[model samples]
Target: MADMQKALRARILGAGIVPRVIWGRKVPQGTALPYLQLFAVSDPRPGHLKGYNGGRTTRVQADCKAESYAEAKAMSDALVPLLAAPATVDGIKFGHTKAEGPQDLGEDTAAGFVHRMSLDLLVWHSSV
Candidate 1:
């Protein structure tokens, strides 16, 4: 699972897309940007969380700058391989979901970045 997260993060940052700083702010070139928190949900085991269903959340921030729509797509494209990759352990499946709430890129003056992402996993042991 950790590998999957790392891979996803690397993929996104490697895309070379720089995001605009909110509404219309200019971000300095060559400036180091903080990573975005990436979330992941793990499959639930039987009796674990008792009837809560299969769900988990993990977040990892990445550093990158988005300057165009294609750049955004490059970031978005990283999601697929991450979701496709299965958990290291057996009887566990995982996938990624988009974040919820408002987004401010890198500004917290008002509310900063407010994205809540979730992943759904199925536990094979549940069938037992």
Candidate 2:
């Protein structure tokens, strides 16, 4: 749901690592450095056929951008732990979140060096 995504964004922002966080796409033009870009790639509902009630698995991507690779990796390091733990955000009870790849993207002419990480979250809510 949209609320889940918003909550996730809020959680990322609350970490206080990056100053800017944008969803659905990359940072906007004229945005400052040391920003984060979040994307909700997929949400597969009814995670399991046996328990086809109120659970879903979402694949999310968090891209950390900075002037240098070290900064980018540091930001990502902070983020990985936050996402890995189970937490409740905006009424959505998120279970364990598994992450993969601080895949080095090397550099970007516009966005600077990038480190992209993928997170798979198991989320569930009673009213869903």
Question: Candidate 1 — which residues are off by over 4 angstroms?
Answer: 1-35, 39-65, 87-128
Q: 2-101, model 1: which lDDT tens digit per residue?
A: 4444444444445443332211134344433322333333433334545644444443333223333344344434444443444332233334433332
**Model 2 reaches what TM-score against the true structure?**
0.80
Q: lDDT values of the candidates?
A: 0.35, 0.70
Backbone clash tally (model 2) = 0
lDDT over C-alpha atoms for residue 92 of model 2: 74
RMSD of each: 9.7, 3.1
lDDT of 2 by residue, 11-120 (tens): 77887987877887745778766787777787777646576667577777777777777888888888877877777777777776777777876565654444443333
Candidate 2 at 69: error in angstroms? 0.7
lDDT value, residue 71 of candidate 2: 80
TM-score for each prediction? 0.30, 0.80
